[model samples]
Target: MNRFKKFMIFGALSVTLLSGLAACGKSEAEEKKSSKNADGTYEETITIDVFDGLANYMGVQEGWFAKIVKDKFNMELNIIAPNVAGNGETLYQTRTAAGDLGDLIIVDKGQQYNELVQAGLLYDMTKYYPGMKNMARFDEAVQKMNEGTDALYGFPTSVSSIPATSPSEGLEPTFGAYLRWDLYGTQNYPKVDTLEDLLPVIKSMQDENPTNESGKKIYGFSLFSDWDGNMLNAGKQLTTYYGYDESGFVLAKADGSDYQSILDSDSEYIRALKFYFEAKQMGLVDPESTTQNYDTLYAKFQDGQVLFSWWPWLGQAAFNTQTNLNAGKGYMMVPIEDQKIFSYGAEVYGGKQFIGIGSNAEDPERLADFIDWLYSPEGVLANSSQTSGSSGPEGLTWEMKDGEPVLTDFGKKALLDGDANMPSEYGGGTYKDGVSALNINTVLPIDENPENGFSYSYTLWESYQRDNTNPVLEDWSSHMDGAVTTMEYLEKNNQLLVAPGASYVAPEDSAEISTLRNQVKSTIVEYSWKMIFSKDNSEFETLLNEMQKTADGLGYQTVLEFDMENAKAQNEQRVAVSK
Candidate 1:
């Protein structure tokens, strides 16, 4: 059956269910007449099923925000939450398959969206997104969401950026190097500038001063088996000064046009693999890193057994609150030297959590209007504010203070006071306060500040010690820089190899491509991990050559070409938009 037809059938079933439930309490006729209308607008009650994770912070439908939407939009919202075992991805897929998709859907998973787009179940919002033209005033990343496949499909919410300065100066920290300052004081722990510098610290912690009660020497660092860990390790292996050429197909650029794949080439992959092996051999990396998940690693940190680990800054707050580790005494971020700390900007694709009309939306226009309201200035304020009653969800705005909208006490406390160093009981601040100004990142007008003040303002200067004076580059320049750097670095630095990209292919691709990509990725990761953790250092050259042969057979050349073309097209499009 067609998606539209299936959606209509589901809508009918929902209407019938509502009627039946209403009839149990009232006469059938009364149930039928419950909806009121005036001037062609549905006075009739309508319910929109929304699949969301808002419950984590906002609680259930009983919240004040829920009441506001109902009262203002004249509609009821039914939210379906996934079970612990089933994340939003599983629930969304199941609902879509059952033809029971919600009127509005908020997808947090990037891979899932790729699948849904292929399934032809999602509404192509290109026709419905005039509301977003205003959003062009926001970051270019936000604008790009509207241009996927040359058609707009979604709206991206605003997110904050990391400050130009480090929370501590004289420390050259990179992504994932979470230095435990509480244990390693500034004097004892000098700033680490290179991977080589990290080794000595790790060795000192391991042999000189083992802190864990179990008598196991605390490793200077820990690595994870998951994708996040992989990214961190990869980033560390290739410092941010030389980032991946996400736009260029070249591992090394030959002339202005010639490109090569680092994976298919010999030197880069081997060097990256060798570094991992050396770290593992030196006992700097967790022996169980390949098996342990984040929670397990976090537990180690909480026990004060770890002096340093790799994770986002937020980990500090989360760890302090959940663990018994003396928040003040056991941990703080360490300073690294000469390293350009590179945290991922909030602007990446698939990071934008979007709410959109689904296949089952009977009143799409109404749904669109509601969404517009949510993204509108007042709506943004309302949705973000804290509510009133204890039983009710706090309004998005807690209360207006001095003409400014003070976030809920929780929000205010989280934003203003929450610091990595602060104990969790003290309410580590929210990401809101640390985020960049909304006017800088969102399409909203800068002049239109909330009467109270900009609630979304970021303390970039207060937070970090770096030079924030560089003019913001145009989106295209930044994008190209990323691509070119990755490509050129791979080509020139034969020893530095990136993990094969084919491993992350979305599930929607043809089975043949998926199988090939998976095999290539699996081989690289397996061999790379083995090399890093091997007890007997086997010849690295032979293994790397074998991996390259496998990648070549898997169509590495084709993949590189495709990447180049895609990058060029995307860059051109971005440039055109700017003009």
Candidate 2:
């Protein structure tokens, strides 16, 4: 039997079992049905199965977020996380073959999504679009995806409202060198001229504060391998510090002026590999990096076992609790002079992922309402709270005070306290557990909410700015020309390389190209990791040369040509959009 047929048989068995159970409690079921409110929402609680490609957490969504959805729509979410389920790719293929992705679907906007669209797996969400009040703001964004087709598959996630030319991030660049402020402060804040300059500075910090309070040794860098793809994700991420963004396997300069093959000896990727290798040699690199996942690395940050971070969000958010900041200890950006940090400008059409309903949805209209709510200001605040630095729901976490937003006492604790607990009414749990598990946002937190006249991000709120004062921040400000924020410093010094947002979607790869890409990607990732942990310089060079030669033999040149053309198209669109 085909997979779809097997899925049907399994589903039928489930229905039969459910029917038998229902028969045993017929009167109770009838009473529950009668208890539903007069509103459009069903009285019988419905469980919506969400197959989310991006989710890190799985199982029934719980805590305050569950309460919010239940109160609003009488619905429970059963999240299906492919990453957690097993091998992500295998799960995706199996589910697709079974003819039921889920009641709702969320995935990145790439080959998989395109294939789903062509296969008619996604519902046409266009009819419900008219009813989505907040979604109107991104009409062009939704339309952009459905240009060649008559049906709308879904709306993109992380849609930004800022001008296309404006920087997407607020207080800090997405990629930068963040160090523990308390440690760096002791060194009189040594200047970081090049990426290599960080070595001695990190060494000094690690030497002085050799261990955490619990007596575990700290390292300058604690990396993870969970996100590796076409190349070592950490290594590719390091290239962003030098004003380049990965376009397929190519490193395209942010200014749209140039590109480099990852195999090039002088490429930023190689430099990043060498940086980690040297850090390893200096005993500043974590030995667990190759084996550890992101969660393990993150826990180390919370314990103050890591001294360096490439992104402010990862290190700063994990380490900078209210307690730490109060004690003048936290991570803060220590800019490198040679860095022209690449910044993604506002993406009005969203980024790589999108949210859509599956074709097998039992209640399309109800699911549509739920999705529409995701685009609403209220839903945005509730779902995105404490995520990407957004202040959550107005009355609960924050309040409008003196015509501006301020975090309430609960808000402050809930938002910044590492071990905060929610009130029973909000579904008692730790604040972290209460956060939305979908792991996808319909709009970026940095976007403005028209109802409140403030961006969804708490970092941009005037009240937050006024209350953000801390010993660490003050010290950093005093040392850096009184610049209160990293954004201000980068802007004033003209060090940010903002990539103008354009409605550019990379074309789907041909089948031959796709096969070649997978092979080349595997080789690149394998060699990249090997080079980072190579025994010596000679071994590192051998690994590098072998990687390049093997990749070329596997058709790297063809892929590079394809990516170069995309770079050209992207540059043209960026220039036009900026104009």
Candidate 3:
């Protein structure tokens, strides 16, 4: 047998052996009570292993979020995060082949998910459907997801109650050209008209501030290799600034008007690569960037060694400590005149992330209950606290006052006071550490909570918005002609390019297409990095040409053709939803 086939057989034998051993140790009553009761509660506290594809943290979950689930369902979440396991894709495949991908599974809703269904690794959740009251809120979405399936295998994440065409993001796009507003403000906020314009501006700021507080050398551009897949994630992310979304090998325009193969000489992906090359040439790129992981890069941000950021979360959240914010020193979005930021509109069916119960779950019914609660208002508030810095649990972190939600003293301290310790009643860890480790949301954070008539996003809450402004925010607003937020400014200027959300799932790639894609992707990823760090423009051009040639020989055109068709289908959905 082949190596994978051998592993599969060994996995089956191992599972059978483990099951037999467990059966021998279990008492008849213990076995009987292990399954969920008719009341949808477990007879005893159970440890639920969550195979989370999106989790940034791994191991057993703890702190306030843990306490909430434990108190409610007598369960503890033991998260198995592939992202933190070193190699996410490999971990996923290995666990999948082992026939036990944890009791609760969260992953992308695509080929891998279909494979799991075909392998009977996913539990049929149809029996518990009636009890999923909160989940039923997205009835149309769920129906669309399981259209051809015999049973309700799973549902997508970040579902919204808003119309499909409306933008779901509260106050920021997923990607942006964020900068240290404190530094920019000092420099009189130089005008940035295009991506190229950012280079000179960033260099000027870098020259002025050579080091951070502790005198650590700073860089205008610090990249990470950890998140790179088919192409450099750092480079690919730049395409979003121009309103393009990654669709397999192609970058599909947000308005569904155009698509470009990443390998195309003049494509945005290539342009981004050249941008990084120029940054490197100018001595503004971090020397350790190519070798650094995301964690290292994020730590650099916290130390204020980075001046530019592509996402609101990365630069703003990591670096904007309470002290910095209090001092009017923090990061904020700096708009480029020629940019049209891509926005994934509030998806009524949610984004492509899928959550389902594993077939090997000890108590699938109880898991069903846990997942259902995630869709409830209480769960949305508590579980999605990471969403745009939202607070959790009405009484614990926030409460209604004068018919509007406001943060309590504890909430303010825990959330904004830079890792304040939580009360012993709320699992005792620092508030930051106490947030959910799953890192997946059942509903959009921007979705309005029916109970409060406000978005689950604390940043978007009227009371919070009114009280949250600092000097940095005020300065940014003034610079942007009184535009209070990046999303607002983008919308006002027609600079936000939203891909209308629809109940659309791209067709699974053909076996031939999948194989071709893997080979082509490997080549692209390897050469893309080489091109970015090339010795000179001549070397870069040579590397790029070599990469394209090799990839084309490996069937780049075949995969590109497949992706183009998928892109066309995606556009059709966008059009349908727009109507």
Instruction: List the candidates' TM-scores in order.
Output: 0.58, 0.92, 0.93
lDDT of 2 at 308: 92
RMSD per candidate (Å) reads 12.0, 7.3, 5.5
Q: What is the lDDT of candidate 2?
A: 0.80
List ranges where model 3 is wrong by over 4 Å.
Answer: 1-41, 385-387
lDDT of 1 by residue, 101-127 (tens): 566765532444444444444555544
Q: lDDT tens digits, residues 102-130, model 2?
A: 88898766565676665556777776678
For 317-406, candidate 3 gives per-residue lDDT tens digits of: 787766788899899998899999888777767777779888778877788889999899998878854435556788877888998899
Candidate 3 yields a Cα-based lDDT of: 0.79
Candidate 2 error regions (>4 Å)? 1-38
lDDT of each: 0.41, 0.80, 0.79
Clashes of 3: 1
